[model samples]
Target: MNWSSAEIGVLAHAVSRAPSVHDTKPWSLEPRGDVVELFERFDVSLPRHDPTGRDRVISCGAALANLELAVRALGWDAQTALFPQPGRGDLVAQVRASGRAAVTELTSARYSAIFRRHSHREPFRLRRVPVRRLRALTGAASEPGVQARLIDPRTETAPLADLLEYAAEVLKDDRAYQRELTAWLSLPPGAAERTSLPWAGLVRRGTRVPDRITFASRLAQEGLLVVLTPDDTRRDHLHAGAAAQRIWLDAVAGGLVASVVTQPLHLPEVRAGLIEQLGLAGYPQLILRVGYPAEAVPEPVKLPVVQEEAR
Candidate 1:
């Protein structure tokens, strides 16, 4: 492996910037001799929102994808093994660095997108994504066991909007869930504590997560894609995350912004509603929205992205 100590540190920063559930970063990185091992820090996971640890593993998978891209951009061939250690659920994946190669345009574009990609929550400009790009996105979203399905708002806006709004109300009224969510926004990842400030309008709250109808209206006008699997096991969620990360990076590479909608789907009602509305065969793991970003992407909170070290 051609990775140096400094390069490993840079790689850690890249992986750290990977989006987590509610920006909680429910994972940790340990730089071994040649490969960096990713572990789920279960303490930081959201118990009420993600009781099954699906989102936690998915968060690590996204980091795994970002780390692999950064490694390739640095001219190394990265080999990854999910759950390399048997029976160790915390060990999400192990990425081994070996050999060396020159960076290609594809790799360069993806690596660059790792920095530009953010889970944008605002409305996208009402524009149809190109057919070629949509095909490319679906291809990007495909991994070993995961598949992507596109939902056209024009064809199914009624149920989509209604379900979204209903899920929002259900989630907002759940005081326990709201309290857990508020805790994350209050302290964030590393902060000691917030100064008792109001969190209603401050946090991103992801795609009408706070019982707002306007966001639902905007969503019906935007492009939606569902990442699904035949079995909704923890392993499937991890793979789903890798696919989701690839989709987001592809969108960013094509000058589009994206975000994942999982909160509302956490409710069984929403999931059943989605299955009925879209007639999807498999378990819907995540809903990804991709479109034109707002004037400015929100600042990264607790994402330790190394601007200078990575380069």
Candidate 2:
């Protein structure tokens, strides 16, 4: 059950790089001998943005994915149990080093991507992601009770844009929500004008959303994936987040950049609309925009490495 300083460092490095809601990193880690425990922090809440705290749980799920990958990349057989303690809702997952295994090229690539992956909020390069590559990305996310689907630019773009437009309107009108969003962005007083670019991010106060047609046109050129689960539950949300991180790491390792879009999906109506319009087989938890970066890659969000500590 003993862990070396290097082993503890790898686990912390991977988890810190996980994408979270507003970069809140709402999770903590406890390395207990052979088992590493991940806990969801209920203390970190985004009231107006994430009313039900679903996104927070999803964020922890991303961290869980990184933890498992770090364990495997370090040559351990990571046996993960989600919500192992039924009474402790906040404990998201526990990864145990059941045995030793040689690290595979794929696992190493994904683990390396943990640091390379970052949010690319701008438009993608004017190039199409090959159908084969897209298929591989989707396959990486095909976990139990989880499904990753690519949006068809040819047929589904218009309807998808309609939903996004609706979400923009809904978010724009909510003053409290806009205030929360602005606070998170922490935009300088004069910097608001620079955010007018199309597809910069989810809509906020004073940000102009392109018309439906224009928005659809821009979306048509982008590669989008929707992560879903058969039912809406805490378990499902965690699965969705894990699936998302796997796909994202795969994308990054393949020289692509991506970002997760859960803000728009936070609205009940938007979720209902995506399911009905897209004829989705399950509930859409989040949308990931993946593609070749159009310009210089933005720096990855840096976090302090995890220190060796037993809980």
Candidate 3:
């Protein structure tokens, strides 16, 4: 039942390319007989930015989605089980090949997008995303206990903008947060920049905060999908990450660009405000801002899906 070298290659490559908080790559892949276990690496810490390790767990969930998709793309029916080990808290998921299966067109497209998808943080084109495309993006995130809510630009933009601005203001003054940024900035550069770490609109010391009205105007032109879950728990965060990546890949396949926004939602006040402002029935885990790119950009370098060893 041990996976062949080719199978391990596919799984490792997909998991490595998953988008993570600050490109921390907070998960590892362990290929066992017929199954690949996804483990969260507790050593990868972002104490100031992700104080509760919520973002790190969510990042692992994103890796989980990619792993499953890779399995399907490899012509297998993937069977996924979460938290399969009772005492091993770091074992987030285990995906095994249930049977051989034909790869469907939908699965193929998503798998192809895994290498192409990267964060687009700059302003989008002024044109609005077609309503139909928005529907498809939301549908991608429609897993159990998960709901994708599109922020209504007309009615909800102003309040949401206010909350984001407040979060930015608070983080800007946080000395510890500033220190964390300084350290991250000091890290030696790596090639993963293209596949990860191109986020914009985050709070940084001395970064000018836009006025609420101006920020609201900017937000109204974008298509934002808020991924929510009924309860906030470790499992919920993991599910949210999976949903976020699914929606993101859908956007990429549809010729759109998007970036994830979880910095603001990390604040309790901003999280509470979103539920009230948007009349949401669940806790917002993250936001996917999707739209056409305002300008062309170089594609991320595609990495070979090859692994040297399996643990």
Model 1, residue 119: distance off in Å is 2.0
Error of 1 at 216 (Å): 6.9
lDDT by residue (tens digit), candidate 3, 3-101: 888888878888888999988899999988989999999999988889899999889989999999998877779999999998999999999998889
Residue 3 of model 1, lDDT score: 47
Provide the global lDDT of candidate 3 against the true structure.
0.82
Give the per-residue lDDT digits (tens) of candidate 2, residues 88-180: 998989999998798888888888789888887766788978767887899988568898999999999899898888887788889999788
Better of 1 and 2 by lDDT: 2
| Ten-residue stretch with the least lDDT total in model 3 | 190-199
Flag clash pairs in model 1.
none
Candidates by lDDT, descending order? 2, 3, 1
lDDT of 3 at 6: 86
1-311: candidate 1 lDDT, tens digit per residue: 33466677768777877888888888888877678888889787677888877888888878888888887877778898888888887888888877777777777777777777776654466685664666679888667879988876566656777777676666656778867877776544522222111111222233234234554455566677889988987778888898899888888877789788887677788889989987988999988877776565533222224233331
Off by over 4 Å in 1: 1-3, 186-217, 296-311
Worst 10 residues of 1 by lDDT: 192-201
Top candidate on TM-score is 2
Q: Please list the C-alpha lDDT of all candidates, in the order they appear.
A: 0.73, 0.84, 0.82
